[model samples]
Target chain A: MMCENQPGALIKMDLGSLTQTAHDPIHLLPCEIQYDGHAAVDKYFTPTICQGVSAKEVSFRGRPLKGQEIKIPAGYIGLVVEENHRPCSEEEGRTVCMKSTFLSFTQWNLETLPSADDCAMMSLMWPKISEAIHRPVDSEE
Target chain B: MELEKFERNNWGSCRLSSLVPPLCRNQHCCLGIDEAGRGPVLGPMVYGICFCPLSNKQDLEELKVADSKTLSEAERERLFEKLDSLKEYLGWALQILSPNVISTSMQQRVKYNLNALSHDTAIALIQYALDSGVQLREVFVDTVGPAEKYQEKLKQRFPELEITVKPKADSLFPIVSAASICAKVARDRAVKSWKFLEDLGDVNLDYGSGYPNDPKTKEWLARNLDPVFGYPQFVRFSWSTAQTIVDSRAVPVRWDDCDGDEKSSSKGSQSMLSFFARKKDDTKHQPHRFFQERKLETVKDL
Candidate 1:
């Protein structure tokens, strides 16, 4: 299940909507949510979503290209996935700006996240609400 | 939308403002565009555009829409009221770029300069008017950059229209003046009415014209300057005026920018990118749906 509490935050999510049904109960997974508040300002599309915008004007420096030439600037490999996966439709090719909808219930929900490099995750969790934030995106949307 | 913390205050949120003038049928209309608060580093910079029938140019002229920079605040407000009363003859729109958006764009390593942002916004408005069935023939624009280059760029974007990008087009052309008034008035109102979501009611403060050199604005910034978190949302942290103040107060941290440049050749330390890249490769079994390309959009709330 996914929890989409904020709009316009740059987030990594499954390409299509992450809901099995419209009424899927979306409660946080019962573990400390790893990534929170990773909003739009947190990152930007490295090459930018403007690449290959106009399908009609698809061309190399001078010569024409076969299929639309999508140049994905080395995607943002940050806390949130801000990369445009290459060779996708115009709409889907760009990194989707969203609040990460799901907790990595498998990897992050483990006993603890690695703190070897003094990661930002160290002080992120407020000991108080550490109990209730892992719910799924609203309606599992 | 940059400052997630100030979600309550518009100081962080950017918005587009539009007032669709009465649609002029068949008769070709001339459009005017101009920007306000381009220099000031405190508040939102607004790009305004207005269009009307060639015949109505006389009416707009009579309204005495002049260069907003030269007009008094009260005078600008009054003229806008008159422009409003003649709504059938005026069609206007505005895009307000907030300080946060301005700062973030400038602050980013791959900078999106203000000129480029303004150009795109103006193009969007012109495109909007054309799409909405308005017949435009000429476009008069006031520019801060080289007029010829600006004109060329706008011409490329909109070839059919007669585009004039000149310095002080607002003063030379009545319609451009109208656009200037619209943009300036909108910004004045936006700044005056801007609300802060964070409750700092105890500290009574007033931000004068957001120009960096303004005594009142400087005083306000000086009073509210924070050592660590930076100033409130209205300040453009990217601007030197704000940057100098913030940097002056910050306790600098030293770093070797080239640390772990060649991780493979180095004995132990790993580059930030290489370290993270190795981790991503470990998750090979993620479901297909989870690997789909994600789409992100910056949205504005009313």
Candidate 2:
């Protein structure tokens, strides 16, 4: 079931061939959704529907038609099903399947990402990081 | 019968009289003498002598006597006390030369005066031992100077005594090592007393442990360009470090003014000036004209 305008709602469908367009739109409603398959979804939709949603075909409000599957775009943000939710494998003995796997959301703002070289250099110099950060004590006998 | 035959063949039986400890024939007395603190830059030089009867050889060995440097201060002190109580005669002499005397004397004679002073102290200790009823037929001194010269000097001081000045006599003779301990301990005590005067100025104003390459001493010298302050009279001022300090501060014009007039009026100066003038007149001659002339004259006469 889909509400035209609800504050928080979940959308689950195979999104394909969805097209919507609008100009001079002032506001947009965002939604969280799940896709059922791995096929690529493509469409031309209203800028409002594509503004916050990172998927290429499935828009914020429109639903996919028959004979189509949904595909999540790269850098999108959503949840995936996992058997365990614990922080580490050593803690699996506890209740509620204490391990969980995480798939990072693909919706990163490209401008804010550090360069690959910067990331590599930071990891290379990590061993001496403590020495650079620690201050010597002033009082010594 | 076999036991009698074996006994007759034994070398011990062949000279049974020699088996008995040889009796003292010459009635000679041996005195072991040693001095300490010669190399130390900061303290007094001390000489000590110890004498014991030849019959008490076992007693000296049982005391475990050795060179003083080989023993810790505590062991030396213990041995010193035991030797003092056990030996019938002992004597000590200390020559305390102030830094000023050591410094000035070193300039003129290059530590000759210091060696002489140490020898004088050693000779005095031997004399004292002899005075206390110890026979002086044999005197073994740890050599400080030429053995013959030192013996000659000692002879001049005590003509009646026979002196044997041997290098490293302390390590060779246990008696000399015992005397070494006494002298070393006495000098160490004197150095400890000097600690009281440290607060008057830089504690390192005196040379660093009197050993070369002491950073504190070098640092002190570098900081104090003038040699006057904090250097006690006990130090040898003639040391090259002192001379370097003096040279660094020397006013060249002042030295010239002091000696310039004397140099101009001397007859020897007039003769040297005339000789150089005549040598310059022979322009074609080699620069070593004086040396060549002496060689040629010797060759011609030959």
Number of the top candidate by DockQ?
1
TM-score of chain B of 1: 0.78
Local accuracy of candidate 2 as per-residue lDDT tens digits, B111-141: 3466776676676566555555555576778
- CA deviation > 4 Å runs, candidate 1: A1-141, B1-25, B251-302
- Tell me how far the alpha carbon of residue B180 in candidate 1 is from the true structure, in angstroms, after superposition: 0.6
| Candidate of highest lDDT | 1
Per-prediction TM-score: 0.57, 0.46
Docking class of 2: incorrect
Q: Which stretch of 10 consecutive residues in model 1 chain B shows the poorest summed lDDT?
A: B293-302
Model 1 lDDT tens row, B204-245: 456677788888888887887644335655677778887777
Interface RMSD of each: 18.7, 51.1
